[model samples]
Target chain A: MDPVTLLTIVVLAVFVGFEVVSKVTSTLHTPLMSGANAIHGIILIGAIIVAGQASDVWILAVALLAVVLATANLVGGFVVTDRMLHMFRARKPPADTNTDAGTGTGTGTGTKGGAQ
Target chain B: MSLLPAEWTALLYLAVAVCFILALKGLSSPKTARRGNLVGSAGALVAVITVFLSVKLDNIPAILIAIIVGAGIAAPIARRVQMTQMPQLVALFNGVGGGAAALVAVLELGHTDDPWVRVAVVFTMLVGAVSFSGSAVTVAKLQELITTRPLLFPGMRWVMSATLVAAIVACGFIVATGSAGWAIALLVLGLAAGLLLVLPVGGADVPIVISLLNAFTGLAVAASGIVLGNVLLVVAGTLVGASGTILTRAMASAMGRGVSGILFGAFRGGSTAGSTTQSDRPVRSTGPEDVAVLLGYAQRVVIVPGYGLAVAQGQHTVAELATALEERGIQVDFAIHPVAGRMPGHMNVLLAEANVPYESLKEMAEVNPEFKNTDVALVVGANDVVNPAAKTSPGSPIYGMPILEVGDAGQVVFLKRSMRPGFAGIENELLFDPKTTLLFGDAKDSLTKVLGAVKAL
Candidate 1:
């Protein structure tokens, strides 16, 4: 974990991030933003590590709270992004007539995978 | 119980990082976007499992319960939130991620004696706190828990400046002395700065602020990676931070707003004068039957929809109206201003929700010129987007943003609740144009009536 190594990784990651999303259509902006938001939920790893290693009760309590927050951010971020994309994928000879209610109640990332 | 050695855990984390890159790439196009999301989710699943297997430590039961509690809170809400409220939900999710990152950094504070690591810790805590607070304010604004208008107070600029200066000073003290007290002070100041940063930004500009804060959270997460010596943390965080920054810029330009103008506009007060005052200027008033006659005769029509359409739950009726018009062999198209509905592309989601076909919902640039050839521009619950003042008035808040030129159409029909202004709080000059006719009512009722009238014709 040299500072120089971290700096190199940050710079390269920045380029990749900018290059990946450089040409998205406006229709995908909200979904894309939500997806990117979800990806950072990987900070859950850092949270897990911190929570698992704490020796003090106060530190453990704070770290465990971080875990809960991170878990929610990660899970919720993916589910909502998935739900939004399900609607965006509607471009055919119409799918379900009640796709709105279907997705509204069934709101599933799994809905996309299993239904298809 | 460690399944993977340190190097193997590192390698798996690296693979997970590449999945994120692919996820963002997949989202760039409509066809691959959902699949891209699935891939990213799979990566997340794998990462979580790997962490459980590769790290052995205390409080395992507590950790599981915490995770379950978190998911229980988030999943139902994300699943159930209406598409119109998508931007705020994203803001809310982004805020929790930032708050979590700040907490992680806080616990790492005294463990690091290295000044550079301490610097990263300070950076993470401050940025994370600011992003968390700023996003909360944006959510409240969008949810209308608070007034949507810019809440400016006396000496607000000075308070913000002083807080920022104090935070910077606290960060330096934490770096020099490695003191927990200075770190806590920096965190509090960061929260204040975030609140101050977003509070003055008026409603029309909250989406951009959310994007900016999303980027802030990403950077904070990246710095937390530095604090913990985790390469995956560094890469994933920087990716979100950098991409979110660029995306914010693109959205601002699409909105015809400079980033600086959005962030600091309240300090330069005169630029944000929005009037809630009703204009009594006479506009031609008509009923659903006359509108049907106008639509009943038109060969070509363009529909301009705004946030009000979503507010009135009129998407289904509006789509029905479009379908009804198309049945008569009229050329009908929906001209979506880029920032239409609240966020960019937001109208597309709403229209898609109502089963409006994708091919007919046209972007502003693609549909602007077509308005000239249009026989009618049926504006439904939309005001400022079609307002000619964007092009004509240099002094207006939304002045330079490109607008759908519905004014070029032969006849304009407005379905509105009242003669009130739009979200930007500016009066629409186009409403008073002689070619325009106002049908006053709730958008759903109005569209339903208009739909029936068009059917009978």
Candidate 2:
């Protein structure tokens, strides 16, 4: 890629990154950080590329190790984040997937037995 | 060389990059956050598929095996890890990512002869190594494998400075001579620098260190992208780096510290100043019955939770108590400080895990004004967050950091393990106030007894 193209992507990404997360409430900060952490696990692509093009057995060994580590980072990051978010679930989901912003409606609605 | 045309490959990669942006955007709102994560994962899957489809590769079986092994080890742990240990787990995952990026950059060293690319490779390797080792130290500190207090030494600053200078010289050597030996030297220096950087940070500031290292890894991955000429890598990496930096800044301010101050405070002994002294002053200590009476009689109650609540596994008990209070027609709200848990906002996750309603868990800014009208304020296993010293005492370490203002309530009740101060080790003046009553016991035991007492009332 040319320097100008790469620089443009970088600049735009920095702004987008800042803009997207700048407004997150403090309650969601941990999950947001964890989610971003998992997103970077996409570095598995770089590991795969290195492993595929390894010139010899020694280089292949290191590249494969990279693959394993990157996969864990990516997979575990997402899984853990989802688990955290699951706790912030809708108080009442009757197989209802959309149109329910459980965050605001969660107050004053749960029975003693319902929430637990 | 790739089997697909360059244009097609670039277009596919662009789609993957777009998925990442959408993923982050969805995370801003609670409702869309989970879907956003799924989209991000879909993008990752597409990126992997694109790499395999566009590029003919050898060792297919080995790569698949590696991925399977990594997932097999990670999934079970991620699914079952206790919420209390989530911070350490995050640091560990981040450390491994940094390690992977560093290793990828190392392999790229042999394939590139361009001096600038070499510089990118060096940057990736150096920053990745630092993030990797720095995150590991943070994990150990959080897990109590080592003392959580800041570790300072004679001439440590000089040693840290020397390592940086040496790493720079090694970078020059690698860029100039293209030698693997210089790369090896650089990696060692990077690892040492990581250790030195995290060792002097106290427990209260470990989350900030983790966030900072997370940003470091993002930048490292970006540098790796530059070396591979992969625009997807560049975009994703930069996004994480930027967001992580902002999060770190937000957490520091929430704790009333600056990024540089937390990182370098040990040089002036600020980070090491966690005072463990038990104040000899008399405090009016009571039992769960009195706490129960206080809660039972109050028309409005606010619960201030801290890391200690999680440490004693009292989240469920506390939640039940809140439910019990609400059943009596009392307005119940949980006042959550931003840095209330091992990580910022972590307490909310812990409470949510206990099935507490999200709306009832109010952030500091939203609930601070409500304390005055609150008839009772419950401090459960939390000290520093509710400590009035944050606003009243100028010389206190936590001064200027916002607190839950439990002092404004009609009566304050604390479920404490002892006179031991909070993570910052600052004595809470509110504990000694006439309006406050301390229940001295483990948070879980105390909350359980209080729950029984409240039900009786």
Candidate 3:
């Protein structure tokens, strides 16, 4: 809870985020954006804390609104990301022949393609 | 009873953070991306459940009702939204997150007397309000509920700057005096500034603006976390802030513009004159039957799809045409521009839904060379990516951006609804090229006719 510890965690998290996200391909960019959007839904935790500890009626109302909006963002973000990623199959099964046509090329090919 | 000790709760949050990182790592490849998403969702569940177990609440029914109502609204929309509308959906969800962060900050302001806490509360409220309104405007633009062009006028930049200055001063006053009235004023001004910031941005810039606003919301959440003294919120929010910033920069560079230029460039009125000369040039037009014949006997065909293809929901028809061509021994591949659709990778998702093979979806670099050997290049509702202006015209807005070399193919066929300019509002010189022929119609209808003609042959 100390300022130094929070700052350290914040700095370390930023580096980790950059390292992981820089590797994502352009094809998965939308899902990456959506998934990250969901992660920030951690603010729902803050919302819960505020609502639970509300001392006044107006504060309670505001915190309740926060809780509702945060929950919506959290649930919607993850679900939509799941839907998008579900469409990205490495190999389409023959039974779904109309949709499945090819294998996913590796990251190396993506880099080569991106270089142009 | 408390389900876990504070130490155990912290440990659980740490585990959830690790899951989020792994989730992103998994997203680096198509093979692992879906599982990555599941991992992230699991982390979210753990975090939420851990909070539920730890918090002792008053007004439980109210909380329950809010959760139910929120879920009810969000779930069905997420489940039923078409792929073409995904960007707008993301923007809408992002707006709610920002609004929630701002409200949390508002609640915090009433509870905290500490100066640092007050500052954090004000910071969160300002950033969150801006992001909320900015993202709402972005959604409106993408949904076609508002004009997608830049709504700019003389002195607009000065007006936006003045609003930002006023909001900051209001925030400073609230932090110093703990005045509720000033806090409310700051929130309203912040929201107004957000709207003004996005209003002058044209449609082509919305994706970057959305990404940037996503980063703003993350920072706002982090500020709220500090107000509440929660490490997990701080870490997750910071991670999002970092990733969103990187993505925003990458998207801007992909379009050959800097972030500052994109934010301030006011593009609508300045570029109209540059496009006039090319509009007067004559273009050769062709019918669907001729396009079908031209495509039927081709040894190789490259399909270039753009936002218009997504708008018309023509991915399935294009895929059907490709399959029909393949059945006749013609080789077919798709060339995707990096910034092709409204969002990055937009075209790929649409095509993947239609069952196009991932390997057959080629990037600009990979497919550009192939066009030289291509017997025919079919452009489906795409213009800016194939425009020669990106490479040749220094005065054009898209001059330095990389484009698909569909012009290099032996023959070029464009399926268009009209000669309207693309999102960039620049004339495509390739349309006037002697090697190219325009077949005007709805993309889905034209592709279907081409499919029928090919089948008849």
Candidate 4:
């Protein structure tokens, strides 16, 4: 394919992706972005391959730049994701018992004939 | 050499853009985000297929292998993560996208020896490195692997400012001499600065910080795309960058925080300390059976759930109790405060997931008046929101925040673990109310006992 056509198609695809992303509210933002990020990683790999085979110095330069940026994104994303998972794993503090009722204190209200 | 008509190509791009718009629209509601994602993905797939068809591939297997491997790892991780952790997961993923864009920029520059390309490579490298490092710090903070407290050092601000200055000088040096070493050093400085910049931010400001980083990533990616002349990259990056910035601003405002306050960790005041004064008044206590007796015969019972419900996984049990109450021919309703949990609409989602009937749930405005007529108002694992402090104390951190007027009910039964303060670290004044009876235990355990008592009645 001609460079112009390739560029055109790529641009269109990205626009579509953006339109989809823009529609997502807070509820869907995270998941949609996550899915898109994976796609970006795919793009990164492509850029890397393209860099490896480039006959022109400019192409090689661009490819290397893409690879660096993409790698950072991939690694950083995983780190943050792993960190968030920790929030769910916190050990709930044991229940404080000093405030427990039904003890000898008559201040405690009870149903008639309620056991201590 | 053109393979496709320009008009058709433009049309296809327009279609892709429409998909993005639709996907975003659908994403506004949780119920539709999944479908929105599918539609957005389909657009991406179309783009990928177009690219595949346009390019002459000598080795298609390599592309297939990469896709399979990447999807295999990501799909499982995505499936395993719970909804609560979704934000952190998003932060991680967004960081990766930023990093990827930076890498792409670097590769694009490496392919060219042109001075302009060299300059673009430097910019992309610095931005990408910083974005990656900043995102990592954010993730660490969110995960609690790193301290949520401000990791501030004396003169930390000056040190960061100096590093940023040095980076700028290094960028100039790289541009002047076209030296790759200088560029690399500049990137390193930016990365270090990114980490330092984010590390000092407290946990309270993390959501904003994450969003800001997301915006930065988007901008960096867009810059890289512009440098490489990838229209797709530019368009996608711009959209992300713009949207992320808007979101960051909105989130900051929603939390009543400013960007500066979030950035410098500057505004830690009375709010952080929580409510002022420990109430000296003693709390009224109640037995499970007595509470159950009151509940069993109550003409109307209102169950108000808070963060405690999420911590104890008590939604299912709460649902069961509601069912039991309804079985006894009592009017039961679950009153949900908008900001009842850590996030908005948190209580609603938890209850919905537990299969509680939507008809039983009532918003604060809808049910606040009902408390007057309610025979028993059962507050489950809730504190600050239902606290009388919001009403009585002008000095309280939660003073101005709107709360459920559970105290107004004829009889208030609070199912709490203890008299301990909430996340804001404030003692709930509602505890001291003569009308309020404390049911101290695990909310689930307390509710179960109450249920038992009710059944026994």
- Expressed as tens digits, the lDDT of each residue in B1-457 for candidate 2 is 5388878888988998888888878866666778888888888888988988887799999999999999999989999999999999899999999999999999999998899999999999999999999999999999999988888889999999999999999999999988998998998999999999999888888998998998898899888999999888998899999999999998998888899988888887643565689999999998889899999989999999999999998888898999899899988999999988899889989988887867788988899998889999999989888887778877666777788888999999998999988887788888899999999999999998999999999
The digit string of per-residue lDDT tens for model 3 on B1-457 reads: 7467888889998999998888889889877787888998899889988887866777767877887788888889999999998889888888899999999988778677888888988999999999999999999998889978777778777888899889889988888888889989989998998898888787877989989999999999988889988878888888889999999999888788788767777743463233422365688998889999999999999999998888887887888888889999999999988778888888888887776767788887788888899999999999888888988987776777778888889999999989888877788878988999999889998988899999999
Q: RMSD, each candidate, Å?
A: 3.8, 2.7, 5.2, 10.7
Best by lDDT: 2
**DockQ scores of all models, one per candidate:** 0.50, 0.60, 0.41, 0.12
lDDT of 1 by residue, B1-457 (tens): 6467998899899889988888899887666787789999999988988888788778888888889999999999999998889889989999999999999998998788898898899899999999999999999999999988888899999999899999999999999998888888988999999999999998989988988888999999999999988888899999999989998999898878899999898788887887879988889999999999999889998999888999998887787788789899998899998788888778888887776766788988899878889999989878778877788898888888778898899999999999889888899988888999999999999988888899999
TM-score of chain A of each: 0.75, 0.79, 0.77, 0.45
At residue A98, what lDDT does model 2 achieve? 41
Q: Which stretches of candidate 2 lie over 4 Å from their true place?
A: A90-116, B392-395
lDDT of 3 at A38: 82
Q: What is the lDDT of residue B318 in candidate 4?
A: 83
Winner of 1 and 3 under TM-score: 1
How high is the lDDT of residue A95 in model 1?
Answer: 49
Candidate 1 residue B211 C-alpha distance from true site, Å:
0.8
Q: Write the per-residue lDDT of candidate 4 for residues B1-457, one digit (tens) a residue.
A: 3456556655665565455455455545544444554565566556555555444443345444544454555556555755455556666666666666655654454456566656666776677677778878878876778766567667787888899899888877766676767766876897888888788766545656766777677666656655655544555555556666666665565454567766764334434445345565688988898899888999899999987877787776787788789999999999987556544444655665455644567777788888899999999988867877666776654555567878778899999897777655578767887888888899888877887778777
- Quick one: how many clashes does candidate 4 have? 58
What does the lDDT read for residue A28 in candidate 1? 77
Ranking by lDDT: 2, 1, 3, 4
Superposed Cα deviation of residue B128, candidate 2 (Å)? 0.3
lDDT of 2: 0.88
Which is the winner by DockQ between candidate 3 and candidate 4? Answer: 3
The C-alpha lDDT values of all candidates are 0.87, 0.88, 0.84, 0.62
